[model samples]
Target: MKKLLSILTLSLFVFTSCNDVIDIEQPGTLLAENAFKTVEDLQLGVSGIYNRLDNTTQIRFNSVYTDELAIGDDSGGQNVTQYSLFLTPTSGMAATLWNGSYITLNQINKILVAAESIPVATGEQADYNNAIAELKAIRAYIHFMLTTYFTTDYTDDSALGVIALSTIPGLNEDLPRNTNGEVFAMIDADLTAAAAGLSNQSSRTFISRDFITALRARMAAYRGQYTAADGYAATLMANYSIANQTQFFNMWSDTDDTEIIFELERNVGDTYDRQATGGGGWAGSLFAFVNSTASGSPFMEMSRSLYNQLDAVAGDVRLARYIDPSSTISATPTTSTDDYLVTRKYPGHQSQPLMNDIKLFRTAEMLFIRAEAAADANNLGGAATYIKQLRDARFGAAQPLPTYASQQEAFAAILAERRLELAFEGHRWVDIKRLGARANVSIDRDPIDCTVFNACSLSNSDHRFTMPIPLGAIDVDAALVQNPGY
Candidate 1:
């Protein structure tokens, strides 16, 4: 995927021209003739869409709104309001995700339309089909993410999901929210087309059939389709191995790809290589003002609760990989100013500070999904086996197998494992939203970290679990419905 960056200039030109035409001129006429002329142009359009797939917005919101992080010493009142659980239609994360997703979706639609007009020449149909498949895969992923954050109930197909934008709409088109079933049907169709059309790709950074499989696994898990989720996850697990301790340590620095199934590549001089003061940039910049060390101007540190959990796992590689060694350890951290658990999870790569690739799907997550599925099926022993397998890999030895007394206990154990493995990677809030209630868990912040505002715990039943439709979108279309309790 390094070639993705080499063609950035051309992709940008094509993307910008298409966007300008869509905004000002009518649809389906001059833009296709101007922007996309050949198979090469469509491929560049795919690159342009890939450039917009970012996870920083979700990472920032998940960490700040949940118990994964605490305000650092270098904080200048950044994200304090959000950390205190004040979410609304005007929230920055909601607006960023909503607007960014739609903008990229619009790009995908434009490229798909343009691809229809370009006639495939001899031996170029593969490239043409691949480019289209990549766009659909990306489109499916973006729609899935929107539903993940916005849908009121993942288990209820009849529930309202985000508006399903399959094609470019008129300028004044104010589409109503679609049901979860409708949006999911669109996602399935796109993924089916993508999986059939895409060639087998081994690069972890690019979209491939494996990427579709992983997304399907995650989506199925979110929807509580345990059997389907297990099958999808098992297929991926059989193909990709969990990273060993050494590989796991190297993974944070972008030196290892043993477990990564899909990740967005962030190279030097790319669009997200800079300090993302707004929303879409290096993920590490979400926690720190500078880098991932104590010397770096960190504005947020690992939460004491999360740190304690990692520390408790004796000889666990995750503890060493996640916490910076330069952190100042306090015997009793009773206040916000006491202990600082600096995070090293994104310790730069390629001479870039605080910049690393955003990993979307990993084999370790597949293991967790399998564990959850096992627990959901009342297979407590199977759930424990999966947990022990993951723990044994992280610890670099055969550890004692965990035992579960009941299905609830097994689910709780799986949730705990997910927290340790996927910390600071943008899964905490959604994890809590989807599984906390069943496990009898919630966002439990450290008392010291919550001393400022006492916003320590949030139940999964809270309406804030579902993000409100952004105020920017609702401001124009007053008829658009917002999430409950907004």
Candidate 2:
């Protein structure tokens, strides 16, 4: 997935030529059927799948749609209303999640098809199998993302989840929604197979057994499968240690590659058809105010509550690494009556100096997942121990360990820590959805943020918790149904 250093041109060409199974543009040079003829070709197809993920843009929106972001002064209201908790069925936001995810899934499916049929030499068998396992894991991941955003309730098996497409779509076929249970089962199976088959113990840029386990942990935690999540998360966390303060900042700077389980690598050579919203040179326009050609930046800012928490503990390393230290924001808009603090998370690369690598999974997330599951299982003290390791790294040894006195207290502390640690990385909404549902919690945004956007609070039972499928998807797929209260 090294867009700059590897066969990124081939990856991009494959992506554009085969984005949608139904509406694919004919490749002037290469054909989809012919694209994955050899094992090497199928491997390139996997890289192309990464290109689609790079441009999904869902991660940026995930922060915006929840309490993680505030409107910037230099903003358009393109998705501001959705962030205000007034979701629209026909909104472009819904389409972004739906369309972007499916397109990625379809690209993965193409790889799967090619991998299965491609003839391999005897020496390439193991490598080929591992590649196929990686594809399955990626396919599982895309489906998990869809169900997380589209399905109403994670625990409701009967709830309508996304279509479970295992093969390339035919023009005449119309797939129906599967139950949440069904979709999750597929994800679990894929990861299980992937973990058993994948042998790549190194390379954070590619899918490995660690990614499958980490994803399983997230999946289990979201679905309230505490025992299962705790087991999977424990295995991974035991293997990967959290980055220390110095190492942590370096990781964000793209200078160090410790603790990152899987990340999208965007080095200086990533100029051809780069997938971020910011277009080519930059990581996505997610954090830029006026960097190069991208414009999405200066549009969103860090939530005030998040800034306060990060700034609460003196000399916290996360403060500078996560937030723009210069405090440079183009505007902070009328409703959001605070200075715009851009996320320094995507500050920029060294050579390009404006783009940031899109980190997908990190070791710290595994620890948090383990802690969350332990708490869910009523092992509060165990949970505290698990969370404190990361907390100590962030807050330094001087800070006292806050006792997880009661289940509520443990829940509150753990979730609060998650909010801070995972800020702008896009875990805010799903964390609230599943955890809020479990605790019957409601979000009360800081009044300064709430009063401006008119979305100060979102209850556990709010219908906005579940989003509608994209209107465009429904228009074509007769078998698909909209989520309730959409």
Candidate 3:
């Protein structure tokens, strides 16, 4: 795949029309072709792929584009107004997600293609392969996320689609979307390779065997393959334990937390400054403000159902940690009604404080995946066990595990637990999408003219789910097709 990197880099230069300056170099040095020959070179090249996630264009803004959170009321007069789901094709959130994911995919593919030629006997060859495997897994993950948002049904089995470019050479080459099945197949293939290469290896918080296993479980669950999903999740949960509640919440603040399977770390100096202010800095400043009075921003109020769910469970520490009572903010003389109630997940830099680590995967989610998968496999008791394991830690040991009469009941509990646990982490939409198959809840956003309360009822059939392919992409490739209702 090393060759692929040079090809892609060269393609970028060619397409950008920079060939005129190619020959005006200074004294002789290692050519671009020979630069990545050593293990360190290969390791550095792979690191470049991991580094891309820190870019605001990719990681920071991309999460918001997913169903994690909408453009809160504060975005009424900002550059991100286009990001609201109520808006159409021009939404910055949608466009950034579409473009950024593809850019990362292209880079991953370049690494995958280039690393193939470098032999394992070379000092970096094994590490290079491992990095390539992780990158492939990450690329697959990105594709899976895009497919979830862009396609109506994965079970449709016949929906033709393309999610960015998976593996195409040359710059400005317009590519069509692959089918849902094709995309899923590609994702599965990549993950399978990742699992094999990453097995039993010790590495930092980039990717590991357990991480790939958890991802496999998640993908399988989405595909409705309950048995396989449950099995994979069970293995991981049994081998890797969930962190305690303090660790669960505090891990985000500590870059080297054991529970974090994969994370994008930020340093305290140059790296930190770059992430905080550079073009890559997409810390959801507006959303942060809305969620906290400390930031002097309005609050993105919680849905009535969500607020009630947390409130109904007495002594639920999550509610205290997750939601600040209206009175608490009201106590502050400067607080406005708009800032009365906001999510406590992200407390901004001034409140709970902000850390530079962007968590990619964690062990807590693995437990939830196990619970859901176990329920699907008719192991309601097992499902409840896993759910209570997490809940007991959060609520306290005195609280009894919520009992369920049947697998269906346990399934409902699992869903609710996911919502409460994973809120604002960008897993809500996918959970909704998967559950919508069994539950009556609709996944669509309301029309632009609708009021906020009424707007929440939009159906899963809403056109906004399948974001429009970027205008730039459509204009370049005649073969490219747009999603329906765009």
Model 1 weakest 10-residue run by lDDT: 1-10
TM-score of 1: 0.94
Please give me the total number of clashing residue pairs in predicted model 3: 14
| Whole-structure CA lDDT of model 2 | 0.70
Clashing pairs in 2: 73-331, 73-333, 278-285, 283-355
Which whole-number lDDT from 0 to 100 does residue 483 have in model 2? 84
Model 3, which residues run further than 4 Å from truth?
1-35, 54-84, 116-122, 163-166, 170-174, 199-204, 255-258, 270-286, 289-305, 324-339, 342-344, 347-353, 378-381, 403-410, 443-454
**Tens digits of per-residue lDDT for model 1, 59-110:** 8888889999998988999989999999999988888888778777776786
Question: Each candidate's TM vs. the true structure?
Answer: 0.94, 0.86, 0.78
Give the CA lDDT, 0 to 100, for residue 436 in model 2. Answer: 77
lDDT (C-alpha) at residue 245 in model 1: 96
lDDT ranking, best first: 1, 2, 3
From the highest TM-score down, the ranking of the candidates is: 1, 2, 3
Give the best candidate by TM-score. 1
